[model samples]
Target: MKSELRDLYQEVVIDHSKNPRNFRKPEGANRSAEGINPLCGDEITVHLKLAGDVIQDIGFQGAGCAISKASASMMTAALKNKTKAEAESLFERVHSMLTEGPKSSVNPEELGKLAALSGVWEFPVRVKCASLAWHTLRSALAGSGAPVSTE
Candidate 1:
């Protein structure tokens, strides 16, 4: 990442972490799942209202590290009105980015604000923090009752 882009991404991460979007349990949310990262004590619940496979609305409620919260916030924003397949594809992309570090094939520019998390791959432990919400979102979309855990 270029110096300026890194700085900008950092700023985006900080801003989202400080004031996460969709940080609530939205009304009429028909699907929900909980996630936890016991290593870092990050916990969250993702909620979604699907209208025939399209995400009609999305929200989350939780207390966690900046990365976790921001990821959830950005995820909700990115996923609203998207189909389940789209969300899952996005998750795969983001998951790859998180695990692959800067060498990941996915383009940061393509992720929009979510590209801010590009740097997180450098920190191994923080990856779990950042991914907790995403895994939970998958669980919610799958309508799974089991709680998610990053162990």
Candidate 2:
């Protein structure tokens, strides 16, 4: 069982790093922001199309470690069609899980493939890698280019 979980994580990481969904600039994107991690030179641009409080579409473009790319891929997938409030809640859950080093407020099973990234907390340096896109998403939602400090 442990080996199976490890394999699942590896496969998810590979798939997202190789072929991340929503990885292109959106046409007429209403919200967008770019984020960078000086620690590892990871960069990402997050774009969003929102209808009222709901995210109609979400996309991202970035170059980073396997964790970063995979997290962004998982984020885009998890947030699609969700209300802005819902997305924010999800973001908080992920952030707390990664940064707080605790059991996530998010149900791991409900997070779908994103559950693969739960192990990232064990690697401190990689936490920023996993959050690059998330910070970008927050900036986009805030309508600012200000650097987001996740720490």
Candidate 3:
């Protein structure tokens, strides 16, 4: 990554961590799931208010590392008003980015602020932190009552 870009990414992460967006359970949420990273003690709950197959709203609340908190905030911002299929597709793209690093095939512009998290792939352990909210979001969307665990 270029120096300027790396700095910007760092700033984005820090800003989100310090002041996360959508960090609450939304009213009228019909589905919700919790995620825990036992390895790092990051825990989050993702909530969704769905109208048919579309996510009318999304929110999350948790106590965790910066990556987890920021990921939850960004995930909520990204998934709101998106259809279930679109949300699933975005999850796959983000999972790939967090595990394998950013790919040229996935345009950063498509991910918006989420692309800032690409740098997290370098720290494998932190991947769980970055992904906890996403996994919880999926479980919530799936209507799975089980809590997600990164073990």
Candidate 4:
């Protein structure tokens, strides 16, 4: 069952990487930010439309590895319609799950599809790949309009 679950998650990652969701600029996004991982040359732009404290819409565009692209795609899908606070909480949780090592106690189920990326911890280097989009999303939410770099 564990292997089956791994296979399922791998398929999810590959599917999203090949055919990303919300992978375009929205009609009128109020927040936008870009993130780059220089080591692997992965780049991502996060676009968000917030209505008051609620995120009405979110999307992304960029060139990256399967892990990065899939992470961005899944993140957008999970965060749409969430309030600013909710999204931030998710960011903290997902960031922890990604960076913390396999010994982490973070419950992936709490993150929804974002949990598919839990396996990323296994590949220490790829942890950044899975987090680029998330960091970009946080920057966009900050309304900095500044480019983010994973250094």
Model 1, span 1-151: residue lDDT tens = 7874464349778788899999888889899999999896778999899899999999999899778888888999999999999999999999998889778999988998898888888778788988999999999989977999999
Positional deviation of residue 133's Cα in model 3 after best superposition, in angstroms: 0.5
Q: Where does model 2 exceed 4 Å of error?
A: 1-9, 101-106, 149-151
Best by TM-score: 1
CA-lDDT, candidates in order: 0.88, 0.79, 0.87, 0.87
lDDT per residue, candidate 4, 1-151, as tens digits?
Answer: 5874473358789899999999998878988999999998888999999899999999998899988999999999998899999999988889888888456677887777777888888777788888899889989999988999988
- Please give the RMSD to the true structure for each candidate, in Å: 2.5, 2.8, 2.5, 2.5
lDDT by residue for model 3 (1-151), tens: 7874473358778889999999888999999999999887778899999999999999998799888888888889888899999999999989888887755366655799998888887777778888899999999999978999988
Ranking of predictions according to lDDT: 1, 4, 3, 2
The true-versus-predicted C-alpha distance at residue 35 of model 3, in Å, is 0.4
Instruction: Name the 10 consecutive residues with the lowest summed lDDT in model 1.
Output: 3-12
Candidate 1's TM-score: 0.93
How far is 96's C-alpha from truth in model 2 (Å)? 2.0
TM-score to native of every candidate shown? 0.93, 0.86, 0.91, 0.92
Model 4: lowest-lDDT 10 consecutive positions:
1-10
* Lowest-sum lDDT 10-residue window in model 2: 1-10
* Per-prediction tally of clashes: 0, 0, 0, 0
Native-referenced Cα lDDT, model 4: 0.87
